[model samples]
Target: MIVFNEDGCIKCGACQGTCPTSTITVTPTYIQHCDMCGQDPKCAEVCPEGALKVEMFTVDENALDQPRLTFNSSLCTSCGKCEEVCPQETCVVVGKPNMEVEGFCVMCKKCVEICPVQVIGIPGIVEPKDCAIDLEGKGATYIVNCVGCGTCVEPCPVDAITLDKVGGTISIDENVCIKCGVCSQTCPWNAVFISEKYPVKREKDIIDFAFDSTSCIGCNTCVEACPGNFIKTIGSNLTIEVPDICAACGLCVKVCPTDSLDLVVKWGEAHPADAEGLGYDAEKCEFIGACANKCPTEAIRVVTKTGMACPSLVQTDEDPSFVNCIRCGACAAVCPEGALTVGSIEKMIDGKLVMRDRIEFNPSKCTKCGDCETACPYNMIHLTDDEKLPVKGFCTLCGQCIEACPEHALYDK
Candidate 1:
């Protein structure tokens, strides 16, 4: 059913969006067929589809016990040898932006010996971590600076911030707080702040948490600080979440003062193993650069050159020498479109235009290999397989591209 059905899947990513594990990587070519490896394959192990006879393969124990592809950044020549030999499309796509190794790796040691500089090694693991936190404690500490000036009231896009006279403090409606950071930026007192990271509920006992209203001085700090508007005040009393409406964003919990919110999860809930975090299948990913904004870990940052080089993202007939592409060959390998090219030239950085050693690219033949996106040194790429940046002079900063982006995958602010 879900086993890469060509006729069924329109490839809009509705199922992948709902997939808790982030297992299904949406690639440019295909949804990444789950070659069922064997009777009890990992693909079939989690398939919500039918019991079809997929594919399989066997490898020698010694082959798997081989050294890994270690990157010796200092010695790399930016040559395309290793990437050309890489069995996995995403294994070693060296673009201007950084690239992360995905799960499709069959452990083939081709990269080990193929690397001209011997950068590949089998450390047995990349920087593996079950979780990461970006919380910036908006707690009671910042509330002291509120001063009840109400300067943040107008900028409060959601009206989550409100100052109460009886309470002699500012109060925030947590439910309505959107965490847009507008009020924080506009606040003259610099009192309001909110947590950038929120904890994902893992254990069964924790349904949610709350804030201490009595402890709340009603400064409306949380209201201005809350990106979600989760907390609010009713007359003199503070309240959050009306029983049925909680998205579990976790913003209100981390930003609240006095620990007013106490998580009361639904009794006896079953948490799926796939819910642990996110898994990205490189081969399945299409390099749309959409996932860059959603990932809290900054893990899925695929830079794109489409918008800058050519607004349509399609290839053009521009001469490689004119554009100053680095021609690192990283863009060539992952290019599903094969539209990129390489030649020596000069370009701009920051604001000053300077002459430098780089390559040229042809926008016409690119099929979206999406590999070169992460293989370059000056990777000015974005999400959606859109890596590498265009010549600075060509960039307009119109933001029209970002606004038009369906995934909102943007490299520049």
Candidate 2:
């Protein structure tokens, strides 16, 4: 995690006081890990250098005492509070290698309080120290503060550490360590250390949207309906072109009457109107252009570019037949531009339109399942699809038709 430089600590104990778990201790040299807590290590939060880090320990399925620590170098500040507070004087300092013995560690916790950096924590108790072996033969040592009390030994299921005095200094076998960090969490003194490697950065290309023209009808429905006003019509054929800023919302394809528009999955493909020399004109857009405004497909995105306040193409004029609409999709079904989609609360959210309680439907998908007709207590839902169309019906202000369409293909506005 993080560490402070040796002799860099001001011995203010600010970190220890700020610690929520009371895990830090002040001593003659610096702060260290306490081995009593089993899994909770709270010392890493206040460390100025972020030297205090966590490690993992892995034990064999048959043996559970093995544990190891994993370090994150990106977080380390190269502070040596670890060395100053270390009970063992031989511990390596951030930049120095002084081998002077500091003093016998009685688990006094004096060093923990003096550390300016909050990089220390108690190692967890799992394996007995006797079971540990120094693989590097680097003069691996343990503090006498480690009582034969065996409080820190058995928690390790892998038997990585042992407590027998005759078994030599406590050691960590690299092969046995699973990098589980359990031992580091249980230790009373902040003694164990771990290191991490940094990752390399790479470059990436930008992303954009594409559309197909064979299915397009040259109808400006998409251009007039787009909420973002990003999509524009350039040719009499109504060839639509998306700029680099196009978010690929697919609304253009949804509004195309002939289903001539399809989303382009690959990049760098020729534009839909490349042969016609026609491209969408972002500047010529008069009203918040189509694809985004009235798209039933929700393939176009207006909210991403212009945000929620963008005006919708739907007019507020109260339809004289508003009371007669049976929620039938006949009007949308006859639409040549695919602009008349049934309004719905869900569709509004998907289109990034202002949220409303109304529900709507797409004529393309509506099977006219008249569940709403049977449930209508009022004689409002027209049984005949063509007769119930919004343009040709005697709707009784009763909202039976609105509730009749299971597809939720009805709107009051």
lDDT string for model 2 (1-413, tens) is 11233233323244444343333444434555333223333333333555454454443345444222223445554464444544423223333233121111223333333332333332332211222223221111223323232323444445656655421234555434332334433332323321110111111112434556766667777776443355667796768865443223344555567765445432222111011111123343322323233333222222222233112334443321211223222233233343233343422323554422222333454455554333222223333445234221222223343343333434333
lDDT of 1 by residue, 1-413 (tens): 11233322222233333332223444223554212232233322332332211332323444333211223333344444443433323323234333222222333433232221222334332212222222233221134435454545655667888876412457776556544344544443334544231212221222445556566655565555543233445654544432222222233444456555554543222222112112234344444544443332222234343432232334544432111122223333334453443233333445755443222345444444445444332343333433343212112222333343364333231
User: Each candidate's TM vs. the true structure?
Assistant: 0.20, 0.16
lDDT of 2 at 343: 44
Identify the candidate with maximal lDDT.
1
lDDT of candidate 2 at residue 345, scale 0 to 100:
43
TM-score of 2: 0.16
lDDT for predicted candidate 1 compared with the true structure: 0.36
Clashes (candidate 1) = 111
The top-ranked prediction according to TM-score is: 1
Superposition error at 31 for model 1 (Å): 22
